[model samples]
Target: MASFPPNRATTLKAAFRACDVGPLVGADIERYYVDLSNVRNTEAIESLNTRLDFLEPAEFCSILFTGHRGCGKSTELRKIQKRWEVEYKVIYIEADAEIDILDAEYTDLYLVIIKKVADELNKLNLKFDAQLLHNFETWFKEITQETEQTVERSVSISASAEAGGQIPFISKLLGKIQAQIKGADKQKQTIRQLLQKDIGRLQADINLLLGDAFVKLKQKYPEYEKGFLIIFDNLDRVPPNVANHLFFDYSEQLQSLHCTIVLTAPISVVYSEKNLSNAFDTPNIVPMVNIYKLERQRGDLEYNDVGIKAVASLIEQRVDIDAVFESPQDLLELVKASGGHVRQLMRITAKAFLTAATRKHNKVTTDDVTYAIKQEQFNFERSIPTELYSELAKVCLTKDVPKDENGWLMLFSLWVFEYNGKTRWNYINPTVRQSDAFQEALQSITANP
Candidate 1:
């Protein structure tokens, strides 16, 4: 909850800052989190919590957590991490931060995981069996043709404190390999090819290290009864080809790692023609909060009060909405138009706040809100293909997203949003549907029918 400031300008500035679209982390999570599980009609947090809380540490389960880019998936993942970290050593890796996302391979992630595990265990003063480390080190060196001398020579010029002379051999080797993969250099493909040849050996070596680490952790901290939980975030940000490569071509590789892992994938993966469940369980989708009703009557879609309140709560938790907006109803108007996409709401709110401040309005007016949404709608419009308009019309009319590439495209582009009622469904984005072209397409389809 937020307290009112005496000056309207102070409130406006606070509103603008509160509307940042980035994921909330650390203390900010306490201040700004809104539980939308009931509104979205999916138990996203509980599903992961139940699995991790109940499963035996040796079970080695993997769950696919998915949603649109800004529907608060990362925030939810952080929540999951917070809940499970007490029992599991959570290694939260941002794929884009650690890998060349577009060009990443499964082996790239393998190296990243190994690097992180070895580094963490080193920090904890836990040592792997010397022979075990020596065997893997010798094999790794033979394949990549790197030894202590060469690694020391290469990284000496620009040495980081973490990968400095004092660290173990595995950490130094992994540091060099991770930099190569992320750097997109000639050696990237060479290393990947070497590891790809013996995928099982790579997985086996890593799992052994993980097992050793798990044993040490259990012995050291009784709280760590359960083993490691790797929260692999931002894998969803990879391009479709990379996603296909990581999740499809090497689905088994992603699953074979020995840990209770939570991985994020693009929404497209849920609708992909491939039966992903055979490889991993059905993806746990973080559907949009139910803004519009499941069915429209008399060609009018009704807003769900529960959904509106949840979306508004997301903003109110950060900003004193009544103080910033001209009226509570005006804030409602912004929420309805936001379509329950958290980032989109923030974007609209921030712009409207800036617009009102520029005009010196005491509060954000409906005109400012409208201007912000229209600007967002136009940006979305530019990305959409002309031919997709009719298809979007069909989705709007049917209240169902087609199970195909077009459906995936519409979702990926944010031209449509998924929801859950008695069953899963989709609807056009409110701003997109408000566009003249969409309205005309809707009319044309109705007239033809």
Candidate 2:
């Protein structure tokens, strides 16, 4: 029932424009955040809040948080940042945006974390030991001789633009290195390969800087008692191979950095062959917001009123539902089709708006909603291999996701929705369930069973 900002009376085109599909960030996030803790089973955010609140200021820990790509993991992480901002100097980094995410290594992550913490400390007018940073800069310079010309040019330009001391200078140099690491694959590989042999020295130098930075920051800002809390977000966007390498193979390196950290991992890692808990703590999973009635034995899916209203409120916060939708029923149908994925709901609603606008309808109608749903169905149908349809049906019939590649694939593709109840359950996506492939598979299972 709460109103969102940038709210106004508008034309159909403006209403369509208001329907943004990207993950909410910066100032816009404040307007659209909805609390789903009561409706969904996952307690990732709450558990994180409690743990971080109680953690010692200088103690280091790593926590893995993951979920489906568009299922609001970023939004939830941002919420955690806000809640802990008073106690921690949170350095929230979007890993993919900063690094070549698919090819990122543990060494690259260490450099990124060091650079970010230094950047944040500089903002607070805090400085680390000059000799420590000089040693690090010299070591990097020795290895980066091949790219000296380019690195010099970048640092020179940045230094001229922003005048500062040693910490700022190192920050600028690391900024250039970070840029090269992200921009050129060859450069990234060179940096990683060079650092591979000297990882101990690299980590040792960074830790020296971290120690100094932490001391200075704690001394300067008494309120920031917890020091730095680095959140490496969107590491979840990496492919499975890359995820396994980063979160599984090099998990110790990922955790060894001398600060509390939260990394977003791919959900598949939970079911990976690796014993993730052995390397890091048990991962915090953000499951889909359950929007269906519970059935102990799998059968036909039905809607849950509370879950339906929770998803519906996400849209109501952004646009005037009554003005855009022909009726509440039409809105409900669109929400049901989303299967509790936040971005999918917005994508479907955006499509419905486009369909209505294209048809010259004053507002969205049932036909518009159906057309939107069908378009999404086609999208899922194309991505999902025909061979997997039966597997999806098995999930729908048995209320269980197979612990095989096919099940993980369904989950990754969002063709199957995972939710927690008395235990975890998987169901065919509402729209995907309506596809001919799923219907036929369901019928085949029913007839045979």
Candidate 3:
């Protein structure tokens, strides 16, 4: 744990820094990670750990890990990587960072996996079978028109010294191709037209290289008995059409790769009518931490003490809450307004801190919280469609999220909260429900229902 300076100004600055509205990775994650395995059904991570821990090195398995953006899926995945580092050569890739994620195909994913695995293996002085490399190089050159001279110039101009050594000519060419596809729409169309016909040949050659690399890796690091674990993060951000093409249209190819893999998928796909389980098995979902106590029989909701503590612990890990807030009630109000979305809590807290400082308050107060929440409410009102108000009202009253596009939209937008008690249910975001339009809509529905 990191300690803060005792000065009041320094403490407030630390509080705001701790409330950053972005994903935490590496050391920052290890320092501040909260175990929510007991809070919701986080068995997804547990099951994945067991599978990798117990499965044979030669065996291949794929799991779909999903959750709304900022629900801490990446944090939990980092935890998984840390736990399995001793046994598996974990290669974590953010798909969006590597490819044109919006137009990505299974074939593109295949290239990334093979390149990354080969690159890692090269670090061990483990070389690929010469014939396999030759075939892939020849095929890629014939298709992409990449020559030795062009490859050298591209590599020299594009790569740093460390990355330069890891990337082979084939991998360097593919990297240039992916960058072109992402930046030039016209070039993407031309490149796809040229290589789509050789997709099968491309896949076969890459798989062979992977097999050779896997064998060499085991020969070098005998203790790394479990082979490779490739995690594809941020595939969840792709548009629905692209997701369908990669996860549905080419499901067989995605799973056929010979390694234990975890792919982050979009949350909406979990609710779609498509039978994803029949192909890749049921996806593991990271639901929101249950911050509210539900009296199901009476339909009453209140802040749960266990959940409040967990959310507060997130802040307390980095900042002393008592030192930053005028009273405990102000902190509680901010937590209640967050509705258990991790990023939302950070944003709201940061806003409240700014609100207090702008007004010269010694510490954050309830008035600062109220003003901050109102600002958030206005932002939501601007984005949410007027007609969806009625559907949101129904969810608040019935506590059931309709199994359709509207429901998925609400969940995606963070306008609703999903919980698993005896079964899955949803409720309106407390802040959204406080909007004047939402209040009127709820009254109308209550009168009619």
TM-score of each: 0.92, 0.92, 0.91
lDDT of 3: 0.78
Summarize candidate 2's per-residue lDDT along 1-449 as a digit string, tens digits. 12223773245565666666666676767777777877886577777777797798788788888888888988888878888889888999988778887787888788789988878877777777888877888888887663446555676645555645344666667788788888877887887788887889988898888878888888988888888899989888887777778887898888877888899987777766666888888788888889888785756878889999999888887778778888989989989999998889988988888889999999999999999999999999898888888888888888877766666677777888778756787777888999998899889988998
Off by over 4 Å in 3: 1-10, 156-158, 162-166, 295-300
True-vs-predicted CA distance for residue 54, candidate 1, Å: 1.9
Indicate the worst ten consecutive residues by lDDT in candidate 3. Answer: 1-10
lDDT values for all models: 0.81, 0.81, 0.78
- Worst window of 10 by summed lDDT in candidate 1: 1-10
Candidates sorted on lDDT, descending: 1, 2, 3
Name the 10 consecutive residues with the lowest summed lDDT in model 2.
1-10
Cα lDDT over the full model 1: 0.81
Model 1 alpha-carbon drift over 4 Å, by segment: 1-10, 153-159, 162-165, 296-300
- Which residue pairs in candidate 3 collide? none
